[model samples]
Target: MSHSQPDTISAALARGRLGISSVVSFVIAAAAPLTVVAGGATTGYAVTGVTGIPLAYLVVAVVLALFAVGYVAMSRRIINAGAFYTYVSRGLGRPAGAGAAMVALLAYNAMQIGLYGGAGAVLAQFLDGYGVDAPWWVWALVAWAVVAVLGVLRIDLNGRVLAVVLIAECVVALVFDAVMVSHPADGGVSFDTLAPSHVFAAGIGAALVTAITGFVGFEGTVVFSEETRDPRRTIAWATYIALAVTGLLYGFSAWAMSVATGPDRIVEAARADGTDLIFTLVSPHLTDSVITVARVLFITSLFAALLSFHHTVARYLFALGRERVLPPAFGRTSRRTGAPKIGSLVQSGLAAAVLIAYALAEADPIVHLFFWVTVTGGLGVLILMTLTSVAVVGFFARIVHAEGLWRSTIAPNVAAVALGGILAITLGEFDTLLGVAPDSPLRWAFPASYGVAGLLGIVWALILRATRPHVYDAIGLGADRDTTALRTPDLVRHPA
Candidate 1:
């Protein structure tokens, strides 16, 4: 407990700070339920012209729940902030782990920065109603500053902020759903959109991918395992709870919107009103003040997601740094708050740079920055989940464990095939998801960047193996600096 040993304190996250509810809040806020329903779902309807969005949400939820069965099972044995990176390394090999690490950093950074575009645009429009005009980047910078400050504070403090915003966002969204359902269009309460047949239709790939993006943040439950109290139970419960809540909310709300607009006209309304479709639906039924409040919550919903993703990206960097995959400086933390100080600042700096670059080019915030970038980030997460599912089987194959066949072998194998198929479908529909021409290079370019990152990481891991063997040996062993020897043993492990 001596304050003199700064290295010991700085290398570790603040332990025993987060509980089940706080962890759930962090995961769900990252999903940004309100933003996904208002922005993502509407975009799905407009861009893909798919009415089966509700079914897509439920489908992805089940797929991820299967993914989580093995995911949380692994979390009990290995506690690391690197999450996917560590799991892949321990289960696969060091080189693959390194590749997964870089992919994760790139993906999470894309996701965190992409939110600035949506948050900035929404905030700017909100202020425009008050006759205070400013560019979207200006509002984005303001949000950037706030998230940057909070990123360096205690992990639980960030969780508390997210919990409050997330609760209000969900409440408002539910109210809107109730109002919309009660005032159905002429067809009156049709459940056609929720049908399974619609899931296999022509544009179903795009709709499924869009729904997958909405659940992108649920896997982040393991990203916080290092800081949670009783991570074994806490992480498992939080993962399931977050998935169930977001999935149910998204599916119910999407169905309600269809009920309000009528199944046939839902796509038309989405195209006309865009993200404003939800508010427009409720406007005739509710007062102006309530609508205004919902709009403000929309902005806050984006902000909450921004903070959550920032934390996720920062922790990934911290894990890499702690393992010496990156410079040791990236691993350092603030002793007082136990936050990943250097990693947090680095992510914030990267986000600011991207914002400035986009602003300089006068890019469309909603289209180019938010929609394209976030969809690509979702693609990265999809890739990681597929890889991690495979890794789960590998990891269990090498060990003696008490976990049942369902948790260790059967579920992971099924999830791997399911997610792998989804990944293929998503890649095929990337153009549709981006609302671009099939011949457009942007579709290939965005997905290819992840390949480049993975390749570079693999090369770097090889370099480390030759030039710096110790660091390479510790590639996925975050905070457990002395466990390198145990890694080679056929060990019987127990839950933490």
Candidate 2:
């Protein structure tokens, strides 16, 4: 006789935790500092001639805003912690959802792990000024320990800390931009910079790539869904607002940096200042004290970003655990807080391992390391997103509203097409972007990561098929409970 087993989701998830306001703050905070961390390459500054980089950021902000047309629409309909998971499962099936989860795990982790290179490099560079000389990995290990402590804290605590950093950075960057704009070397603010002619000039491609760097952590809104008071409204709002805010902020700074140095000054500025171009541009406008503040904020900005991604990876692991995609271990939550302890532990472990490997490799943790990791990670996420866009169109068809084909079907379809094209162009230009060899290690790692992730999905599905069909059937589904009897958990919480 066949029997039905209790669902892992129902068993795992607990309620009465997160609110909408905090969730909004979390997502916006996460997306803002990506540029300071990732856009260190001269290409971003070179392409747009500094002034045009902000324009490029605005362009992507507009592009992403358009994509959010469908993204928000879908978010309203699908309310699960496992954003990609549910989208794929509803649109495709268990197998596809399973695949997306694997890909997302690898992609997010790669992004997080990539930060070690960035953080270590910045720390090393900053420390080198004071004549402290240890390997970059030494700093990364210290950073990793910090991250591990962060992983164990309350989500709200993380939000409060990030908000302070995000706001401070925004103020610093904007103030610098204002100063640069007010004091242009060449007569006045050039109309040519904002004009379409300058934006698409021969060198604009590199600047556009840098501008794109400002938007990497945009999708982090979904991770806070389970905690949010109203997942749909908050996520929907955060998605658009964060993109716009970060775009404008980065856009203003990039433009200002160009203006401060005058026409054809970005390259020279970079040469004179090295990787400190962004901060250096602002130094003349502020006191030496404020310059120090800006530099410190840059590091803090990365920490905020790390805290945000830490939440994201934990949620992915939690959802996978709750669904039994990987194992029940990930599904287990704290008896007090309802946060997924087991899943958080697993995610933390993986992050630690990746950090250790880079330390062991003794890699030069500069913008180059940051560049390769993000490009690969970005490509990985793009693959997941393309799959999700397809899934959104399909899943919404059967279960969601049947109103306009544009929101659910046509718009997402368009986003998918556009993203695919961008991905193709980016891959073609990877060497150009990095100034590396054709057969460089990154070229292979980028595709290989995607391939490995997809293969892991196949392997996972096979394991589920052989030993855990009940768990397998629950793909893309976040919290589940014992429908037959929830009196126990309630009594435990209340403790009558």
- Give the whole-model CA lDDT for all candidates, comma-separated: 0.90, 0.66
- As a whole number from 0 to 100, the lDDT of residue 465 in candidate 1 is 90
lDDT of 2 by residue, 195-225 (tens): 6665545545445555555576777677676
Model 1 lDDT tens row, 1-496: 3456465357789999999999999999999999999988997888888889999999999999999999999998888899999999888888998999889999999888998999999899889989999999999999999999999999998899899999999999999999999999974789989998986787777888889889989999999998988999999999999999999999999999999999999999999998899999999999999999999999999999999999999999999988888987788889899999999999999999999999999999988898888878888998999999999998888887899999999999999999999888888888888889999998799999999999999999999999999888777777676756355443223111
Model 1, residue 107: C-alpha shift (Å): 0.9
Best by lDDT: 1
Candidate 1 colliding pairs: none
Question: What CA RMSD would you report for each candidate?
Answer: 2.5, 6.2
Score candidate 1 by lDDT.
0.90
TM-scores, all models, native as reference: 0.96, 0.86
Q: Candidate 2: list runs displaced more than 4 Å.
A: 1-16, 34-43, 46-52, 127-134, 191-210, 400-403, 480-496
